[model samples]
Target: MMNILNKILKRYGDIYHPHKQVMESLKINKYLYIVLILIVIEGLLGQYMLYLNKDIWGIIFLLFYGMTIAIGSIFHFKYVEKKFGSLEEFDLEKMNKFVKLVDQEVKIDLTNKEQNQIINQMILEKLERENIKEQKKRAFTGGIFTVLLIPILLPFIIENNQDILILTVIIMLVGIAIIFFSFKSILKDYSLKYKLERISDMLKEILIFSLRDKSL
Candidate 1:
C-alpha cells in the first residue's frame, strides 16, 4: 500500500504541474488547514461581536475580516485558474504538434490504419478527460468562494439575523465538505497527472527523434 505522503504527493502533481514542487515546499496542506481554522475563528468572532458593541472598531474589524477572506479567495481562484489555463495550453500544444506530425507523415505515406485509429482514440480520450478535470477545478474554486461569502455578507450588510446565522452555518458546512471532497478526488485519481506526464514524455521523444533525423 502506498504511504499517505506518497498519495498526497501524487495528488499534488495532478492539481499543480510546473509549480507542484513550489507549492509543496510552501507546505500548502498545512497552510490550508490553518486557513480553514482561521476562517472558523473569524466566523465565531463575527457572531460574538454581533452581541457586543456595534462600535466603529467592531465594524472595522468586521469589514477588514470579510475583505480579507473575500479578497484572498478571489485571488486564490484566479491564481489556480491561471495555472490550470497554462497547463491546458501546454497539453493542447503537445496535441497540436502530434497532429501536425501525423499530417506530415500522411503527406509522405499514410500511417497504418490500426496505428491511426489507436492514436486518434488516445487523443480524444485525453482531451475529454482534461476538459472534465478543468471543469471540476473551476467548479470547486467557485463553489468555495460563493459558499464562504454569501452567508457571511448577508449577515453583515443586512439587519436580519434569524435566517442569516442558519444560512451561515449551512454554508460553512458546505464549504468544508466541498474542500474535503475535492481533496479526496485528487488523491484517489491521478488520471490528469498521468496524462500530463505522458504528454511531456511524448514531446521530449518527438524533439529527440527530430533532432536525430536532422543530424542524419
Candidate 2:
C-alpha cells in the first residue's frame, strides 16, 4: 500500500524536456495526497462513529467527503506548473501512426488528405490492437469478485470488540478502494473502446461509399 501511495504521490523532480512536454499534466498535485490520507482517516472515523451508534456524527463526517474533491481541484490549479517528463505518459501527440510512413508519405502517390486518412486508420488499428476490451473484461471480473467477497468477509468484520471491528473496517476500506478504482478503470477503458468503435464504423462506411463510387 505504501508503494502504491508513493507512486500516486509522485512529485516532479528535475525533468526538463528541452524540447516538448511529452505527457499530460497531473490533474491532482502531490499535496492533495494529504487530503487523500485524511480521506482514509475520515472513512475509519465515520465507520467507528456509526459502530458506536453516533449516527449524526457519522453523517457529518461523510459530508466532509466532498472536501477531497475540493482540495484536489484547488491543488490542481495551484500546482499547474509541472515539469515535462514528470507528467503522465498519456499525451496523444507522442502516440504512433506509422514509423515506415515517416519519410515515404512525403513522396507517396496519395494526397495529403488521403495520407492523413491512412494515418488515422493506422491510429485506430493501433488503439484497438491493444485489446482494451479484454482488459476491461478482466478488470470487471476482478472487481465484481472482490465486491462479492466483501459480503462474505463482512460477517467476520462485524464483531463485539471495538478495536477488532475498527481493524476490520480498515481492511474493508482497502478492499473497497481496490474495487472502486478497478471498476473506474474498466469504465474508462470501455468509454474509449466505444468511441474507437464509432470512429472505426464511420471510417468503414466512408471506405465502402468510396469503393462503390469507383465501381460505378
Candidate 3:
C-alpha cells in the first residue's frame, strides 16, 4: 500500500517539478514555498478560531487562506507562461546546430512535395509530444492545489456542530467537484495556448532548416 501511494504521489508530483533552470531563473519555487507556508499558518489560525467558537474570525482566516492560494496560483501561472513563452533562455543554439548537422548528413530534396510533407508530419509529431507534456503539467498543478486544500478545510469542518457539519460536508463535496472540473478546464486552455506558442518557435526552426536547401 505504501509503495502504491508513493507511486501515485510521484506521478502527480512530476507536473510541479520545476525544470532544472526553473528555480534558478525564476526564483518561483522559493516564492511558492513561502506562500505554501503562509497558507498552512492561516489554516491553523482558522482552525484555532473555530475551536474557540469564533466563527466570524475563523471565516476571516479561511478567506485569507484562500486569498493567499489564489494569489500564489496567479503568480505561478503568469511566471510559467512567461518563462516558457520566452525562448531566449532555451538552448535553441544546440538545436539549431543539430538541425544543421542533420541537414548536412541527410540529402533531402526540400522542393519535393513528398519530402516537404514528411517534414510537416515530423513537426506535427513533435507538437503532439509537447502537448502531452503540457497537459500533464496542468493536471499536476490542479491536483496539488486540491490536495493541499483538504487538510486546511477538514479541521474546521470536523470541529463544527454535527448538523452543520453534515450539511457542510455535502456542500464541500459539491464544491470540490466543481473546483476540480473548473481547474481542468482552465488548465487545459492555458496548456494548449502555452504549447502552441512554444511549438510555433520550434516549427520555425525546423522550417528554416528544411528550406535552407531550396533555392527561392
Candidate 4:
C-alpha cells in the first residue's frame, strides 16, 4: 500500500533525475519541522498561561501559533504552493539497478565516473532520511505520551472541573490524530534506509574491484 508520502512524491512529478534537488528539499523539510516545533511550543505556553488565568497573553500566543500552523499546512499540502518535501522523491529502484549495472560478474565499462558521484550523494541522502525518521519517531512518542498522560495527570494537576476535563480530552485526541499517520511514514523510512545502505555497500564493493584492477 502506497502511503500519502509516496503518493505525493509521484503525483507532484518531483522524482526526476538531477537528484541534488532532493537534497535541497530535505533541507527545506528540516526547517519546516523546526517551524512546526516552534508552533507546538507556542501553543503549549499559551495553554499554560491560560491555566494561570493569564487569558490575554494566552490568546496572543495561541493566535500566532494557529495562524502559523494554518499557513504552513496550507502551503505544504500542494493545494496552493510548491508543496513541502516536493523534490524529495529519489528513485531507490533506479539506484538499485545502477548498483547491479556495475556488478563484477557483468562486463560493463566504467565510462561514467559519475556513477560513484551519484552513490556518494545517495549516502548523504540516507543520512538525511535518518534525521527525518528520528524526528518522526520523536513526534510519535511525544504524541503518544501526551495522549496517554494528559488524561491521567491532568486531574491531579488541577482541581476537578468539567471544563478542564473536556479540554484535556480534546488535547489528548488531537495528539493521537496528528501523530497516528506518522507511523506509516516511519516504516517507509526504514525500508528506504535499508535499501540505500545495501546499495551503498554494493557500490563500495565495485569501487574496490575497480581499484584492484587498476593496480594490476
Candidate 5:
C-alpha cells in the first residue's frame, strides 16, 4: 500500500521545477525584444508613409504587419515544439543509457533516499515543460485560424456604410471568438503544465533509483 501511495504521490510531485521559470523568462524576453523593435520600425515607416500623401499602400502594409504579428506569435509553437522535442528525446536517451549501465551491474550500494528525491524533482520539472509545449502547439493552431479570419473578412467590409456596419459586427464577433479561444488555450496549457510536473517527479525518482543501483 505504501509503495502504491508513493508511486501516486511521486507522479503528482514537482517540488522544484525551475524549468518553468526559465522557459517563461527566456521566451518572454526574447520575443518581446523582437516585437518592440518591430513596432518601433513600423511606427517610423507608418509616419513616413503618411507624409508621402497618405499612401494607401502604407495602410495596406500596416494591415499586413498586424496580420503577420498575429500569425508569427502563434506560429512560434512549431519552433518551440520541435526544439523541445529534440531536447527531450536526447534526455530520454541519456536516461535510458544510465538505466542500462545500472542494470549491467556497475555499482549497487550507492542508492539512497536523498538522491531519489532529487531525481524525482528533475523528472517532474521536465514533464511540466513538455506539457506546456504541447499546449502551446494546440493553442497556436486555434490562434492562427482566429487571426486569419479577420484579415480575410476585413477587405470585403470596406465597401459602403451597410458593409462597414456588417464588417464592424463581424470584427467584433471575431474579437470575441479570439478571446474565447485564447482562454481555452490558456486553460489547456495550465492543465498540461500541472500533469507534466507530476510525471516529471516520478520519472526522476525512477532515474535516481536506476543510477544508484548500477550493480543491478
Candidate 6:
C-alpha cells in the first residue's frame, strides 16, 4: 500500500513539476490560479443561468465574462513578462551564470578547443532538459483542457435538440483542433533539439571572442 501510494505521488509529481516551475519562474502562478478560479465561477454561473431557462442571457454573460478574463489575463501576462523578463531570457541568464562560474573554476591550462567543447556540451544538456520539461508541460495542459471540455459540453450532449447537439459537437471539434495545432506549433518552434543547437552556436561564438580577448 505504501509503495503504491509512493508511486502515485511520484508519477503526478513528475507530471506537475514542469508546469509548476514555469509558473513560478514567470511569477504569475497566483495570478493564473485566480484567473482559473474566475473561469470556473463564470462557467458555473452560465450553467446555472441556462438551467433556469435564460439561455440567451446565459450565453451573453458567458461570452462577456470569458472575453473579460481572456483580455485581462493577456495583459497581466504581458505586464509580468515585461517586469521580470521572459522565461527564455531568464533561462539564458541562468545558463550564462552557470557558464561563467564553470569558466572561473576551469584550469587556465585547458585548451580553448577543450573548453569550447565542454561549454557546448553543457549548454546542449541544459537546453535539452528544458525542452523535455516544456514538452511535458504542454502535454499536461492539453490533457487537462481535453478533460475539462467533457464536463463543459455534457449538458449540450444531453439536450433533446438535435441542432444544439450538432453545434456542440462542431464547437468541441474546433476547440480540440485548436489545441492540437497549438501543440504542434509549439513542438515545431520550441523543440529542445533546435534550442540546444541555437544555444550551442551562440555560446561557441562567445567562446571564440573570449579566447581572442585572452590571447590579446
Give per-model TM-scores.
Answer: 0.29, 0.35, 0.32, 0.35, 0.32, 0.36
Say which prediction, candidate 1 or candidate 6, comes out ahead on TM-score.
6
Tens-digit lDDT track of model 3 for 1-216: 334323322332333234634454346446777887899999999999999999999999999999998998788766655766644433454345434443454544333456545654554555576568767866866686678667766766777656676667766876787678767866766654454444345546556755775645
Model 2: per-residue lDDT, tens digit, 51-165? 9999999877777766765776666555653533432322212221111233243332122347536644664664665476667767776776678767756665675445676
Q: Return the clash pairs for model 6, or none.
A: none
Residue 180 in candidate 1 has what lDDT? Answer: 85
User: Between candidates 2 and 6, which one is better according to lDDT?
Assistant: 6
Ranking by lDDT: 6, 3, 4, 5, 1, 2
Per-residue lDDT of 114 in model 3: 66
Encode model 5's per-residue lDDT on 77-156: one tens digit a residue: 54555665754553454445444443344332113456455555554655656677766776786777767975778677
Q: Which residue pairs in candidate 4 collide?
A: none
TM-score for candidate 6, residues paired by index: 0.36
The lowest-lDDT stretch of 10 consecutive residues in candidate 1 is 105-114
Any residue pairs clashing in model 5, and if so which? Answer: 105-215, 106-214, 107-214, 107-215, 119-204, 123-200, 124-200, 124-201, 128-196
Query: For candidate 4, lDDT tens digit of each residue in 1-216?
Result: 124223323322232323544454445465566667879999999999999999999999999899888877665545213542332333333433444444332333332356555544656675686878678788767877767767766765676565766677767776676567566666767666654555456456556656776779
Q: Which stretches of candidate 5 lie over 4 Å from their true place?
A: 1-128, 131-147, 195-216
Model 4 scores a C-alpha lDDT of: 0.58
Q: What's model 5's TM-score?
A: 0.32
Sort all candidates by TM-score, best to worst.
6, 2, 4, 3, 5, 1
Cα displacement (Å) at residue 197, model 1: 4.3
Q: What is the lDDT of candidate 6?
A: 0.62
| Model 5 error, position 92 (Å) | 32
Q: What lDDT is reached at residue 124 by model 6? A: 61
lDDT of 1 by residue, 57-93 (tens): 5666667678767865665555545755754554544
* Index of the highest-TM-score prediction: 6
